[model samples]
Target: MTSIALITGASGGIGRGLARQLSAQGLRVAAVGRDVDRLADVEATLRIVADTTTPEGAALALETCVRELGAAPTQLAHCVGTTLIAPLHRTRPDVYRELIRVNLDSAVYMLQAWLAALKGAPGSAVFASSVVARIGVANHEAIAAAKGGVEALVRSAAATYAAQGVRINAVAPGMTETPMTAGLLNLPAVREGAGRQYPLGGVQTADQVADVLNWLLGDGASRLTGQIIAVDGGFTTVRPLVK
Candidate 1:
């Protein structure tokens, strides 16, 4: 029997990478995203289109997946997020609200909507957090706050669902190379500065992050829960300037 995995925000970036990796691992993937066209191209067994930022949208997405897939997902990965970079003083309240809704609220809604199916399947659930959850960065007020909430939620979900055999964890990545960061990487100075700042001398790729996520959802990480793994290319542990 093939294990089923449901991934939110599967249209692009880390989410899309994870969907591809999971499918390659022989897990049937249910790719969910707001872009139907992009989701359709994911090469998964099923595609679901939903905003995921609202309770109703999440519920409908979960319902559609369960009804169409013929089995509860054995793994759930919430990879949908939004970033609003601005100094605290300059950040608007609406920006904060939207970031929270996208990063934190979506995770909560997706987990809650599929909690039953996940528990029934004895699954593992992973959330995409950021290194900002533990470290501070300039112009990261909104996203940091939202991801911090995600970290806390991961711990709570792990604890609350342990008895039900559902494992919950998070992956916190640092400056990754994706379409979202393509513009920054295009600037030679910015790219060089970012590269020099990491002990590994460069940013991570979406495939690297996706690899960790795949491990967490697979049987290899069956004993892990409530853990926050940092796939940061040593950025979290190194202080190049200090060295």
Candidate 2:
């Protein structure tokens, strides 16, 4: 059977990549995002314009997707997130709130709506996390805390839905070059320094992370659930040799 996938944040980097890749794999893709213009460019079976950060918006997104596709989506790729770089003290309450809304709240709302749409049918969901959620990273307090919540949500939701054959997982990436990171990566010195922090000595691209997300949603990952797969170029695990 051909898989139907609903992808939130489908106008942006990783989400767009997933839409293209999944479409190539013959899945009927429903691309959802806030920007109609950008989402129009995404290759998918249906393009939905919705915020997806609020419960109403998430529900509308799923409803519209199903209405257009003629069936509920069995696969989901939630690529909605933000990259906030700031120390706890330096981070404003508004900034922290936005981070939570974009990263954590969006994931929660989307997953809830996705699960409801599935209605006991087996499905798979892959959302984005951050390497900072796994380890302490300076000047990343806000994003880390929000994504930590995301990591926790994935595990809890996975366990709750496992008996029904529903799978949930996340990919934690480090220093990927996307529009969200454009400000930080535009500077030569900053970009180089960011790259060096990874033992593999380069940042990930949106497509690279999208590949992993795609695999986790496929039957190849039938046994994988509630796992936070790190695609951070060994940034979280490897200790480089001291020169």
The Cα local distance difference test for each model comes to 0.88, 0.92
TM-score of each: 0.96, 0.98
Question: Candidate 1 on 55-83: residue-level lDDT in tens?
Answer: 99998888888899887887898999877
RMSD, model 2, all Cα superposed?
A: 0.9
Candidate 2 per-residue lDDT over residues 16-119, each given as its tens digit: 89999999999999999998998888999899999988999999999998887888899999998878777799989988899999999999999999999999
The candidate that wins on lDDT is 2
Range of the 10 consecutive residues with the lowest summed lDDT in candidate 1? 114-123
Against the hidden true structure, what lDDT does model 1 obtain? 0.88
How many residue pairs clash in each candidate at the backbone level? 0, 0
Each prediction's RMSD to truth: 1.4, 0.9
